[model samples]
Target: MDFFAYLTRFYLPFAFFVMGESMQGISIKPGILVLVGNKQLEIIDSVSASKIRARDLTTGEVLLISPGEIEFELKKAAPMSNPNSGQTERTSLIESANEADIELASDRYDVLLPIAGKRPISKKDMIQCTEALKLSASQVYRLLDKLDTNIGPLSLLPQRRGRVKGVKLIEASAEDTIQEIIDQHYDGPGITYQEIFEKVKEQCLAKSIPVPSEATVSNRLRERNPRALMAKKYGSKAASQEFEVRGGKVLPEEPLELIQIDHAEVDCIIVDSEHRQPLIRPWVTLAIDVYTRVILGLYLSLSHPSTMSVALCISHAILPKERWLKLIGMPDGEYPFYGVPKRVHVDNAKEFKSKNLEDSCRKYDIKLTWRPKGVPHNGAHIERYVGTLMTRVHMLPGTTMSSTKNRRHYKSEQHAAMSFSELREWLIREVEIYHKTTHSELKCSPLHKWESHFKSKNGRFSYPSIVDDQKRLLIDFMPFKKRTIGRDGVKLHTIDYYSPTLKRFNIGSRCIARYDPEAINKIWVLPEGEQNYIEIGYADLRLPNATLSEFKRAGAKLRADSKRRVPAAEVFKLIRKNDALVNSAVACTKEMRRMRERKKTRLTDSGHPLNEKNAQQVKMSTSPSPDYSVKPRPYDIEE
Candidate 1:
């Protein structure tokens, strides 16, 4: 076997040092004392490929032996009888050797030595030493001449060949002026050497000083380190792009140890849930496990991603998937991968760095790490996943593709075939399929890998359960604001929220209010030092389906329509009026369509076809629930 192979197969202790020339001729070197069987031997040298020369300690005789024939332990080096004396002797020997070499070289060159309180060497003695050293007479004479000029021993050594000093055509003052001009103009957009040169020439003319040629200034700038120049002129961003430093790769040891979360805009257009008309692409928030490259959880919504989206995605990742799967109409299956990550890597987006997010992570014992700004590769795994998912989305009917050039001549809105609900279901199925398919790097399906991780003995998968109630978790993630309770109610975004319980609190007292952005009909109010929250409903409770975004949109529309700053109360009133009108129109349109369909159906001579009216009456009696189209008031909002 080769020496490396041998070392790999055997465990070598720290004391042993192995040295072998090729694999064939392996043997211990001279001066190493070792034991072979019952014999103690001092290695002399290698005689052949299989034979080693060693002196038998007992017999005091040399012998040749095969290395494989013996098992041995290397004898430890003997300690000095007197450590201080040994150290002193070693120091003295080193000094003596240095002096000897120096004296020999000087004598060979017939050079005069300068020793303190010692007579210099005579010429005859130097000549004799030079002749004894066997150096050529001419060489010795030339060395002596160099020494006579006070040249040091180190000076005699050869040096690398290169220009030690560059030729300077401009004076120091002119060079400084040129450098100043370059520094001043370097950060300017599309700045050129000619511009800086012209500036320098103009300055020289104004000062009545000699100006250097343009070539000289260009050479000076070019000679400067490009990276340093770029940094000095343009900034670190430019320098970083021109000169990149590869960072160490992060490889987590176990699943769920580290997770990366990011937000991406999905590239396909889907119809809105309420309007049932094609809307802009939705933003998707995704969380992925760094170790196994498994997608933990994702959130899809028409609204732009926010801290709430991040929190919701994290909550989904930590919770079990059984409930979510059933809600999405998927077959009975387990999404067993879930746990509170030890560390979460995210970008420096405002939502990622929010105080609430930081506090929540601290509460859960998860360390939050923000990748350095402009370093997208730090979170490359999640970025790549987003890109891969977007590629699949591009294959859908209403894809915007990636860029405008790719989307040229294609109208995504007109080609859209899926509603928001249908798109969500499709995404869910795609995610499931992605979990089952083999990962390019993992060599196994993410689901299979996750299952194996749980089953493995060394996995030590810990199930992280929510510490607080689900409602509390949701409340913690909700957007919070400090407000002073007024005589009327607590107003947020111009919408008044009130509760009978709030009336007990003193007016003008500061309190905390938390509300879901997606559902602004009700908010939870907790007075200062209070342990529980009182639910507060909107003053105009009829607009229970209004969202925070919708309220803001209404306000903006009102302002634009009036061509002036509209009051919050007026905006709220207009929003309700517009919502009522739209709902009434939608209801009337649906009724008209139903009546047209009924008229088209051929009825017998009777008012209805064969007892169909009776059957319809019976069905209506069995299901007497109110129309789900009407917004339901939150009764629990009141005290």
Candidate 2:
């Protein structure tokens, strides 16, 4: 018999059924624990059709038991006074049959004849059994007929209540039309069941077929495959999340096996490097290893988060930290971690979902996973790390704190003490401190955890080696754009870039240019179908320190100042001359006003506040120190 059929027949009294064994009105399958007699027993094997091989749960003794005996024991041990007594018993049965693929069986075994003895069932007994099971007299007669016959109660157990056959009320054609309407309109915004019903009515009337009622239509729509319906109406993304099986929490066994990258605007204000004027808050992108919770790399920039920032952060993560540490003036061992991660988990931000990042990851054989939107727990590790880092940033001068309410009456710009370079160094030191400090979740320093994991004898720990060509790898991760080589030069953002290597290429031929937006001094150009890129400098080399943001800002300032369009060269010149003054005038004027106020309120002698005239008189009265000339100090000095 089929599994379900067998379940409906022999194992109907019990709540659960396993394939290949039966015991005490319950199917005791292999690997299931059950209460047999006074002791719990695990069914090890099905020895025969009527007997099961079971091992004692406590004593480890093995024995055989009939299916009837197991059922009797289960009944005797069942609680008698619980409100949900039946449900509790069923739940217990199900809990015991925890083996995979077990099926729930019918609970109508009370109607079956007892299999223990061959005594014929009496008419009174048959009537009593039928009444107890709520079965008809004809069914009772059928059971009686099966006594001593091959066709027994087991043979009749598979029957169920329902029409064996029926004539269609709603024709298949009408049904198909209703389904089509549902498919077309269900996903549309603000769609409703009434609208769907109206559409189905129209289709049915036009086709001259009987229209199903609104209730029937609603039922059919509800019965449609949930996953398929969701995919059609909402989107595949929603459907996958709703129906897809999610993986459990994963802890990587090896470092660099999985990493998470995210960006956060540092909580404090910082001054510009050249102008020393307070600028907007800088952004910091961090890449952290999942296994040891160690920070792999970090990139700090004035620009907002973008695909370029993600690329730069990941590139830094893959490269050696020695040069970077020395360049940033950090100690050698401050950031010891480096290697290409096998996978990177990121949020669904446009920058992280960009084609450039996807392509770069694919090229490096790295798996890039975007966490589902609104599901913060999936990326909780990095999110928590960002929060922890921001807590430290809040303690610095000029911090905006957590919110506007928290920052009430505080001037982040006025209180700002660190320049951009200084902030960078401070962040590095903070990151070092974080590495040395014990993590709340890990209960040990990240550096210590990383070192111990590697040094352990367990084969679970593994180390990912660094890349060979670090420079080439960094270049590969930089932002790229396509341009054609021309006789004059390749123009990028109104600036001409040229290289001696371009002389070999034909004019009008296309090439790819890779650049760092923060430093527009030079770009790397790759010829079509070539693996290597040649370095190209801007045609106007004097503006070597010009960045993309500076150029844009310069253009904006010129437009605002002149109130008219001007040549690129004029704008560039204006930028070079007045870049520092462009945004510093208001701040400088405020500083100057404050200084004048201090001068005006100066205190003089006798603890009295001095006005302008009194201060001048006091300044004039103060005598300068005298300098006495030495008159040929020694007698023999004129040799």
* Cα lDDT, all candidates: 0.67, 0.68
lDDT of 1 by residue, 292-386 (tens): 78889777766678877887788777766665665455546546667778899999998888888888788778899999988777898999999
Native-vs-model 2 lDDT?
Answer: 0.68
Candidate 2 segments exceeding 4 Å error: 1-247, 272-277, 408-411, 456-463, 542-545, 553-570, 580-639
TM-score of each: 0.53, 0.52
lDDT of 2 by residue, 1-639 (tens): 455463344323432211212342454567665665566566788888898888775567898987665632222212222225545444444444422222212233334535212234567776677677677867655644433212212333333356533344678998899889987778844677898999999989999999899998888888889898888777877787689776798788878899999999999987644445566677889999988898888887667787668876888888777765654445564677888889999999988877778888988989999887767668878888899999999898889998999889999888878766688778878888888999888899999988886775764655668788766676777788899999967877777888777888899989888877655667888889777888787676555245566677778888898898755566667665654463456655544333222222222211111122444565678763222322335468665
TM-score: which candidate is best?
1
lDDT of 1: 0.67
Clashing residue pairs for model 2: 23-67, 24-67, 24-68, 24-71, 187-233
The residue ranges of model 1 lying beyond 4 angstroms of the native Cα positions read 1-245, 273-276, 331-334, 456-462, 486-489, 501-509, 556-569, 580-639
Each prediction's number of clashing residue pairs: 0, 5
